[model samples]
Target: MTVTHVHSIDTAPDPVRWPDIARVPSGVTARFGAPIAARLFRRAASRLDVRVALPDGTNLGSGDPRAPLMRVHRPAAFARRVAADGLIGFGEAYMAGDWDAPDPAAVLTPFAASAATLVPRALQVLRPLVLPGQPAAERNSAANTRSNISRHYDLSNELFALFLDDTMTYSSALFGEVPARWDALEAAQHRKIDRLLDEAGVGAGTRLLEIGTGWGELAVRAAQRGAHVRSVTLSSEQQELARRRVAAAGFADRVRIDLLDYRGVRGEYDAVVSVEMIEAVGFEYWPTYFETIDRVLVPGGRVALQAITMPDARMRATRGTYTWIHKYIFPGGLLPSTEALEQAAAHTALRTEGRLGFGSDYADTLRLWRERFTANADAVAGLGFDATFRRMWEFYLAYSEAGFRSGYLDVQQITLTKGGAS
Candidate 1:
């Protein structure tokens, strides 16, 4: 496999790669779908507890007077957007300044809670006809995986550093207690890593294989436990930063950060641990993901996987449908349900040992990140991101937060052992 080190982009990203984000809807969908969308949205909003404030001074929903409010600035444009793209359009409308909300996440929570039933049954049947499918070029093939990963992770190292904690852990942090405090984030991150390591049984002289290296924090922690770590990732930007962090932590000798796809990984390890990286594997490649781990692990070796999950029924409902997230943020990502994950593992020798779910902790983690990102808006702009990009990012973060906050999504740490052995 060819290895090329990726560097931070100096200027704004290429526009051709993001055609939909900055687009203005017109033509048939915009003209015809607007009025239809307006009626549908009003009907849907009335059922949710959140308040929707329209330009005509009409409010939908029977919630308290102070309920989380979604203020639609340009009702026609907002309706047209929803008509054209569904939830993706709603997000685009926010980026286009057609809507405003003091707390977007709060306003989005009730809608997320009613996700399965938000759209009328008649309209839900038209989803396959209306929504786009995953782009063929962005599929999780070995070659395409690099491009998919680069589209997001390789955007800029400094960009992520603005909102992420000092550890640079990108996945969810496991908060220690209820109502997680922002100041407790770094400690909670360490606790999350420690728990994964413990589950994988990493120790002195243990050989560890990490499928995703998010800036080397996990590798450094593993090396600190006297384990030899081989961590792989497809993102060049991540690999470069992770290597520097490992060396700075004085574990350069114990840790190896490689810019390699997981499918091509070759090694025999005592334990394999992957943090929330499986989402990018794509639903079709799930079996391959686990089988690779099984093939590379020694007998009785353990695996710890942290993933964002949805309900099994919901997973089946939305598997092939593309959304705002796939178009703008995570190109090839698809969250798995607990049942789907187990079924994938069953394809290999790995058997589920135990699992822990703390989705609310993820909601807290995202809240902090969003707050920090909003606070660092100037810094983000200085880094050369445009307002549309910022809004897209804000919506992405808040959208994800709402997913967990509403119990529509979950994050789980699952442990698996080879040969069904304890």
Candidate 2:
């Protein structure tokens, strides 16, 4: 069988000339096989504003140069991959080190929203599920959790410290009630937790269990409100840091941090709250997860389940880049559509009490994190991480922000109560 070679440009033009943009490095030209791919590159780059200079005059293409970012690989291949696979290919290529942009979502947002772009991609995606390996739903064992969390969360706390707020809360978007004060985001998070507690009707001296607690923020705050809190997490680093924070805040008597899986926790509590943790649990385990919550909550107890959920069936069909997130970020992770959540809870004793959608605010929250991350790049690099790790993180934040901006993602606050509650 003869090989059908496709030649493509490896990088954007050197900010020198327009027509010269199509020129590929000799090595890249030889690797990609020439004229056909070169023509493809020229055509694709012509359609995008792929070039920009940083304040210091560094040439960066396909993203904001001053920010931690990357440019898509040979514009032609990126076009073809996205035209064929939608966000999956875009993310896959980035993870595979094939191509990159300052923000992968910057490259993807425009493509995802365009009917012209998606029509071809939808057709191509349907042609074949080119991804190799088992689907996340098929590999639902607990063994997968360690590696998955480590890929993103196991990074040094020092690195995260550079980007996250002083409190070190790393999950979901914060809701800024004031919209003007810098502390509004943290205040919003506290207020949201307060709302969860109020909806649960859990008062002073109530016992509470928190699943997937990050940095013990909710637990610490809840304890301050007079609730006894027990929190669990899969990350050892998070466990240690949260324990320290809880102690520092002098809430050790009220807040307990247990390094255990959510499935193993056995207790009856007045209230159970899980914030942004369900997505990482994957769809295959939803039944078990919900059952665990139902089992742990006492009769008339409340469960606050906050997560980032997709809105509808149509969005579910378009699973974004399984490759990048699976390999580099949250592995074995799947975002549940709202319908899926309701279906999972249908047979359980838990009843929905309060539901609020905070999807729009995530874009702002992510943007803030991006700004914080950008402002602290030197501190991040000083943490002894290499360029690749930095690039991976930058890509993660920017792409996520873009996803929120495009409305392909959502952040939701859902409160459920046992039988006999309002």
Candidate 3:
């Protein structure tokens, strides 16, 4: 097998290969692996609200009143993948054009609903047989965190602008009240940010610290409320744009956007806010991540965190697997469970004050992003991205949407306080 390190690119689409490890399964894993899992997969689909059309022109789970349809063009390769790696293979099938779905998220929702029980309970001990361990190169250490972040966050501002809302907030949005319009994404993002700031008690004379400044929108908004803000990020591309945006907002005097790691910060602040940033800290460093927040926060200081969480059981099961998402999108990132977050905070002075779950909002947010991305495909491809790159992004967005839609994942806005009573 050929081993080439392909990055989440900004300059150009990665070199396309027959079996690109960066995006799809490779060699034996792509072909001669497992057919047994394919048989089980067919059985599993029979229980869900989805239709799978095999290459033989027959269908599985037909007559489902409310399921999505998937057409397979290559059954042999698809079966091998599903047998070898389970869900990862299914994603690769989409990336490889082995399968097509009118509604990709819909096709995935049922599987996500049954993910925890995909394999028999007695066979759970053999998880490692199909799931691979975390890659050594992608381990989230202080030294490698910057590179891991750069892999995704540095992948061109032009590329992101093609899909993200005007605020450039890549995290989940809070569309307060249902029956919301699709175009309300930016407003929802602001609402989400404001809620976090309010929870952190950021206001006139407040000192605010923000980790993971994506183009500085949060810092600018906080500074607008007369707060002095310090925002840090390891992404050079992100920090550059954030600095410019902060200056453009006329908050350069009050808001400082720096290219620094959270572990390197020097001063204590009255409030700390990080929106979906902890997901990138890796499970191993979660304790240190929380400790840094605690140490830099003054006594009675408040923290507002917007995080993506999975059920604790799911988190534990997949924590060791280096997934396709890690290989192609986030590199070293890992979503945390609320239970894991609380456990990590056990050694810190921070305690959860209140928490709100809004997984549906994230589903809506992802749907909008995916639609926008699909609509702007021409502009995206015009940026030198190829067909393969485009498909990968589409799958990433749709996959996330399905995760939220299936209730397999959730987003939370949590308020924490220093030396809190809990």
Candidate 4:
């Protein structure tokens, strides 16, 4: 027998040759180690024209002039985790305290801005591979729905109330021309509802149905505009609050909020609207969702669907920082691609009338929420919630702001009218 000696890099430490490092998938391979990593780094450098204008330069690691404002960490098993699982692994690593960056938003912003960088990065992040099948769970079962909604909405209304506007609307971002005024958010939300109603062309006495109405903002606004409003939501807290608001506004008869699914809705209406709620319907249920909307919308009626949309198929499922939202904030939620939404409505009599994208505004909206939440932290904590809950919410707001800033998320208002029904 002949004995062969193999030198292990862990013991030898001669810059740890590429071959000695653990194997990683091809995607991560392009971003790690000397040769390939250097190429990728050079590409990023040239693209970003890497520059840091620091006065004292004390904020950066190593205080190296060439690497100002940049910190690099090469964890031994980091590449392996990112390569094998992509966003899921990366997120887990972040949560498990495996990775640290001084400014996550600043580090990710430049990469997000470049289309060339984003395309390849998205592909690398989304490349699919087969794995052993796990046991199937029941599809949108009642128990599942309750658990999903409760994970986030049922936490504590008082906590949400502290940060949210007076109406307690908990949907997509609100846009305003000015940033300083709190009423700007509320005004923007009402304006959004008005825009939806105008696009729907609903006149006085017209009947309207709103699916997933949060806090009755839209429903009450539509009712005030002289359109009878019927709204539905899964959250009992939302339903009760909305009901009280509607009654107080003297539109209890005109605006009705029901704690039910859209599929349970009956009667035909002149218009339909859903805001920021469609993401929770999941991709598998989009067809049913569209069908339900179409069924209750009368001939020649219009439907306005407002929800966050992914720019591409790769983003349809939550990724990176958004996985935290799925696990802790919005379990079972999935943003839909524009194509998927269009395809879901294909079988219906509806046709797209107008579309608007508000991806940038979401960044501003989230930042505002984070500031408000932080400002009112003491009051929110007084609502009998633990520190973990507060931290969870803070993390939620910060991570969401990061996502919107990165353009990995979007908010879209899609207007649809029944086709061939004029």
- Top of the candidates by TM-score: 1
lDDT of 1: 0.87
Give a tens-digit lDDT track for model 4, residues 1-422.
01111111123212232222223344544344324333344345455523432233323222344331333343434444444444433443333323333433444445445533532564444443311111123234444665677567767777788888876777555474656346588776666677777887766898988888777877777877798988888888778878988998999989888888777899989888888888887667888899988888888888888888776646543322234356556777778888888899899888888898887777666666766776786797588654345544655665666566778778888999886575
Task: State how far residue 13 of model 3 sits from its true place (Å).
Answer: 10
Q: Candidates' TM-scores?
A: 0.94, 0.77, 0.92, 0.74
TM-score of 4: 0.74
lDDT of 2 by residue, 189-246 (tens): 5667777667666668989998886878788878888889999988888889999999
lDDT by residue (1-422, candidate 1, tens digit) is 01111112234334574455446678697789889988888888888877988878888886698777787878877887888888888887877778867788888888899999888788888999987877898889987999999999999999999999999999889885644776789999999999999999999999999999999999999999999999999999999999999999999999998889999999799999999999999999999999999999998999999999999998999988888889889998899999998898787889999999999999888988888888898799899887778877888888899999999999999999997445
For model 2, name the residue pairs that clash.
7-37, 69-102, 70-101, 70-102, 71-100, 88-321
Given candidate 3, what's the lDDT at residue 305? 95
Stretches of model 3 off by over 4 angstroms after superposition: 1-18, 21-33, 420-422
Model 1: how far is 403 from its true place, Å? 0.3
Model 3 is weakest, by summed lDDT over 10 consecutive residues, at 1-10
* lDDT of model 4 at position 216: 80
Which pairs of residues collide in candidate 1? Answer: none
> Ranking under TM-score, best-scoring first?
1, 3, 2, 4
Which regions in candidate 2 have their CA more than 4 angstroms from the true location?
Answer: 1-73, 76-89, 92-107, 114-128, 133-138, 174-177, 180-183, 314-321, 420-422
Candidate 1 runs further than 4 Å off: 1-23, 420-422
Candidate 4: worst 10 consecutive residues by lDDT? 1-10
lDDT at 167 for candidate 4? 61
